[model samples]
Target: MIAIVDCNSFYVSCERLFKPHLNGKPVGVMSNNDGCVIALSNELKALGVKMGTPAHYLKEQVARGEITLFSSNYELYGDISTRVQAVLEEFSAGIDPYSIDECWVNFDGFAPGQLEDHARELRRQVKQYTGIPVSIGVAPTRTLAKVANRASKKIEGFGGVCVLYPDSPQTKGLLQRFELGDVWGVGRRLAEKLGNMGINTAWDLRNQNAKEIRRRFSVTLERTVLELQETPAIEMIGMDFARERIMTSRSFGRLTNDKGEIREAIRQHAQRSAEKLRKQGSLCRAVLVFLRTNPHRQDLAQHNPSMIIELNNPTDDSREIVAAAIQVLERLHAPNKRYMNGGVMLMDICERGTEQLSLLGTQQSDAERQRSEKLMGVMDELNQKMGRGTVRIGTPSAGAAWHLRCAHRSPRYTTRWEEIPPVRL
Candidate 1:
């Protein structure tokens, strides 16, 4: 059987972890630049504060004490997520951390009664450790477990854990009630198409001939539906220990006709990407730089250019990544054009130990790599403990013209003292 463990109101719940007074209040977390709502509490949802609703539109709600808004506190949320995952790991033999607030666990070889008890224990442990509530759903298939999870949300007596065994009456009822769109892999477009064919419910889709579904739809859809009909075909492997590519991108607060500001933005992006590479104990063999004018603004002259630079050797050294990034920047930059966004993407990444040295040119000396690694380690440690960007490259300074305009951003209350949120008694 597969079990899905999902956190309730994750971002808002993270805030409530330390501030228990917000238990029954309407609260939400804003997206980047404090532009819109990304996470909302149950109270906030009931008040019609829809997800992705711009904060500006909710000003009246804020004034009326109808909603409390918070900036995205990634540090606090990440730490809490780690704690919750740790608690879950203690019980389940295998776990797939699907997202920040959701995970899938393998529960095979366990009896039906044992599965129910284990699910309840998982909820209790996670709540006790992280002060956040979670819901667990168990079924023969991952898709059916997801349906059981939805049903659990409606039944308060379930205590946040629901099991949908294959032969159970509740499981059959759930399949009949759930819409096709509500299934795991079906999106709006596919759901509408399926509904046209009268495949409105989960059971209906499951009962359809697998080969007919493949020929009518696509191979991917057919496979997904087939998996949902029985036990989950996918298996959870061990954790992802290897690092991948590192990237840094952002839209500027204002359109920049000046080339100097564009260069500054690219430099800052390169520096940020380099920092991320070092954090993951990885190095880059290629760097990609790109810039674009605001496509939405028809008034501005259009210019979109991107260039990739291959390195002579893979290196975690910030200087090397910065140099390669600048090479691409020079190639992509256009004259007499206003650029609205610029970014650096570090690719062809590999672990520090596995990186291949330049065959022709003398490789970066051991002392040089060691010095850079030490500096990056110190910077990472400081940032991890004190908060991100507390000590960062001066290129992204407050006075930079390319800085994002985040006037409505809430203070980093848990990370920085000066920017801490003010609490009212």
Candidate 2:
């Protein structure tokens, strides 16, 4: 059997972990720059606060103090996510971390009759250890596990865990009740196409000829249909085989046309991206830098420019990546233009050892490679032991002008020592 465990209202739950007073209240989390709503608690959903609503539109709620808002605190979230994953490691041997708040567990050795009991215990232990509520779904295929997860919340008597078997009679009604658009792989366009064919549910899609569906749509859709019928063709791949792309960007607290400020932002982004590359043991051959003026400000002259630079040899060194970003920014940067945001992207990634050395003499020597690797490893270890930014590239000096404006951000309760919660006697 395959099982998927997903955290419930993850961002809101994260905030509630630090502030217990916010529980059972209408709470929402905003995106970068506090622009739009990205997460909504059940209470907020009940209050009709829709996801993606502009922050300015919620001024009335803010004034009334009916809704609690938080700026995205990624440092706290990432740390808590790591803790949650560690707790999950005790459950099953075959674990695939699907996302920050979700994972798949394969129950190869466990008895089938005790699966539900095991899932219930799993949920109890996670909440006991991490203070995060999770819902689990168990089924024969990964797709059905997702379905069972959704049903766990909506169906009565599930108690945070739902199991569905391919041969069970209940599976048919549940599949028919679920909308086609809600299926795992079906998108709006595909939903509309399927709707025209009078196939509007999982059961409808399952009844269609798999070969015909493949001919009409593609093999991917055919696989979805087969998966619905309880055939396990979709298996999780290992991390080594996974493709990855890392991008770090943020909107400024205030728009500035200063070249130095823009340079500082891109440099910070490059340094952070390089850190992630080294953690994954990957190297990138291309770096992309983008700069843009705020489109909402009508009085300002809008300029959005981006540039991509390809390196002769792939590297995970922060210095080389920052240099490449600055070179591109020099070409893309404009004078007297108020830039609202800028970012750096590391692309064309490959495993560090898998990268073939160029025969044309662009590759570094063995000694140089060893020194670079040692320097990066030490830097990463220091940052991990201390807090982030404890040791960073030298481009960002004291009191940098490009800091983010997080007026309502919560404390880094999990990551920082100074911000840890106080216990009352």
Candidate 3:
């Protein structure tokens, strides 16, 4: 059997971890710049505020303290997610992370009859160890596990764990009742297309001929069709494969024409991208930088420019990557453009040992490569041990325009010593 364990209202649950008093209260977490709601608690959902609703739209409710809103606290969320994954690792035969808040758990040696009990125990232990509530779904296929997991979460009688067998009557009823869009890979548009063909439920899609589905739509959809019929066809290739390109970008706290601030943002992004590249044991041959004005506002003059700069050698060194990024920025930077966003992309990445060396042997010196590796390794280790940005490429300018506007952010209760919660005796 396969199982998937998913955290419940993950972001809101993380916030509530520190402030238990907020339990059962309406709460939402916003996106970067606190622009719109991205995570919602059940209480918040009951209050009719939806995902992506503008944060300003809830100003009156916030003013009256009816609902609490928080800026996206990635540091806290990431730490909690790691802790949860660790707990899962201790129990299951094997665990594969589906996302920060979800993982696929394999039950290889366990008895089928005890799967639900075992899954419940897994849920209990995760809560006991991490103080985070999780829901588990067990089924023959990963897709059905996802469906059962959603049912366990959204249904009340299941008590956080639901198990379904391919031939079970309960499974049949579920597939019949579930909307086609709720199937693992079906989206709104695809569901609409399937709906027109009378494939309006999970059962209907499962009944379709897989080859016909492939001919009509795509191989991926055909895989989903087979998966719905309890065949495991979807392979998480993207999750298993190393990324071909790495990108880091974000909207600024406020728009600015200051070249220094734009440089600062791109510099940070390059440093971050380089960190990822090294972590994956890959090197990039080029760095791409782009600057853009806010596309939503029409009153302001607009400019979006991008440039890619090649490095002397394919490398994962932060210094070289940041230098290449800055070169691109310098060439693309247009004065008085009031750029609201900037980004860095590491392109043409390959495994460290597989990079094509220049034929002339006229590349970064051997000693320089060794030193870069040592320095970057030390920097990564220090930052990992002492928190990110402890040993960064450069000091960020105070009041930099690229800084995020997270005015209502909660403390980094788990990751930062200074932000850890206080106890009253």
Model 3 residue runs over 4 Å out of place are 238-240, 362-364
lDDT by residue (1-425, candidate 2, tens digit) is 89998999898899999788999999998988788899999999998889999888988988899998898898988888888878778777667888878888777787878888888998998999999999999999988888889889778778899988659877787898999988888898999999999999988997888889999999989988888889886877755453477898988878988898889999999999999898878999999999989899989999999889999788998889999999999999898899988999999999988997877653457668789889989999999999898888764654554677666789999888999999999
**Alpha-carbon lDDT of model 3:** 0.91
Count clashing residue pairs in model 2.
0
Over 4 Å off, model 2: 238-245, 310-312, 354-364, 395-401
- Candidates' TM-scores? 0.84, 0.93, 0.97
Q: Lowest lDDT 10-mer window, candidate 1?
A: 234-243
Candidate 1 per-residue lDDT over residues 176-209, each given as its tens digit: 8888888888899999999998889888887898
Off by over 4 Å in 1: 108-110, 236-246, 253-268, 275-283, 330-339, 349-357, 361-395, 399-425
Q: What is the lDDT of residue 199 in candidate 2?
A: 96
Residue 257, candidate 3: C-alpha displacement in angstroms = 1.1
lDDT of 3 at 306: 87
Candidate 3 per-residue lDDT, tens place, 214-314, comes to: 99899989888788788888765434568999999999999999999999999999999999999889999988999899888888889999888888889
